[model samples]
Target: MKKVILRTVFISLLIFSCKRKQVDIPIFSYSILNDSVKNFKLNVNEKEPIIHYEYFHQKDTIKRLFFKYNSDKDLLISNLDTFYFNKKTYNSKSLQFKFYQKKEINSHKRFLVFNKNYGLLANLAYGSDYLFLKDSISEMDKKLLFKALFYDLNKIETD
Candidate 1:
């Protein structure tokens, strides 16, 4: 009986120890705006919020701007340009410009995921916002917007 009880306790402890650990999942939320220029905004609770922009154009060309907020509510903006050299070609050219205020070091991994998945809302809303902003922007701005947003999304770090 003593030996059996010892074996049972050992087995229980082993099973408990071998159980998998819980991983932390981030909660993400966002908003979209459109009028004259298009825009997208995303916020991850306890983390910074991201904003993107696009302009109106008759041609297929696109211009874009991406930005995020620091703890102090300062803006870090990245401008991007996406252009197609040929209609049939899958490849495209992109240029990137980055601007931001310095802050404490923190991983932006979750932000990347949120951006990639939810960033489309910005594009959809840009036309309406363009009307509201009452500004005509260049095609280059659209391209830059996409590049900055996607690049930031891809840079998310995972430990």
Candidate 2:
């Protein structure tokens, strides 16, 4: 009986210790896409929308980021580049995000986040002009881009 209790306690501690840590990044409230583009396209199918988002950071240096939704509206293509003066090194990362129909989120007010294990919630601001621009991004991509841009933009805005 004592051995059984000790084993249970050890198992519980092991489970708790192996749990993943929750990232504590702050969520911000701001439009993530560029709203002033003159030739942005609007979605025509009515059933889906296209998305386009760009991020620029130029405090001590310059950083440019761009994300675009594919024609099918189920995929995202992102291009990011940054320069560091301290290390005199240039770094870039390109990533693609694909959404599963079952994982999309349709909430009115919630930030979009793509979890590695759980996938992303597809909730975008419905009436944003840049988002509605045809050929830009699908409705789902718009939501994802909003969060992706915000995740990086907030870093610049807050600092």
Candidate 3:
């Protein structure tokens, strides 16, 4: 009986010690896409250039930001005031703001793609004239704007 109790105590202490040593992981990545020339493509029906921003979070803190571009572009832009607490519950912590803007040429077409894991958020296409003249932005201009926006978002620090 004493030997069994000693074994139980030792096991309890081992579990408790392990739990205490568990570290809090932070989510560290965040990005914004803002480039028009290199990050944008025109006249290809099958190819579309994409801008990406990645964020990694553990223990509810930002830890890293990775940005890239790909042919299968997946982008998400959100200004949600609260984040989902669970799969259903909502928790308000702070406000978030992000703006996406793009424009192309007069004869070409431009598309804005956004994804939210479960479904598509936005997949907008516009004619070149409307994108350029109406929006007062060229393809080159669009790239510059996106680059600027991405850099601005990168400057934000989440603690």
Residue 124 displacement in candidate 3 (angstroms): 13
Candidate 1 residue-wise lDDT, 66-126, digit = tens: 4332324333333432221111111123322222222332432112111222221222122
Per-prediction TM-score = 0.21, 0.29, 0.19
Candidate 3 or 2, higher TM-score: 2
Residues 1-159 of candidate 3 have per-residue lDDT tens digits of 999999999998976554212122221111123322111111111113533333333333443323333324323333321111111111112312232233223453333222222111122223221111112345565555445433543455553
What C-alpha lDDT, on a 0 to 100 scale, does residue 119 get in candidate 1?
23
The residue-level lDDT of candidate 3 at 131 comes to 19
Which ranges in model 2 have alpha carbons more than 4 Å from their true place? Answer: 32-96, 100-113, 117-125, 128-159
lDDT of each: 0.31, 0.35, 0.30
TM-score of 3: 0.19
Put down candidate 2 lDDT per residue, 20-139, tens digits, no spaces. Answer: 433322222223355332232111111123344433332312433344444454444455321111111111143333222223435532223332222222223345312222234444
RMSD of each: 18.2, 18.7, 19.3
- Give the TM-score comparing model 1 with the true structure, all chains together: 0.21
Q: Which 10 consecutive positions of candidate 2 have the poorest summed lDDT?
A: 83-92
Candidate 1: 10-residue stretch with minimal lDDT: 83-92
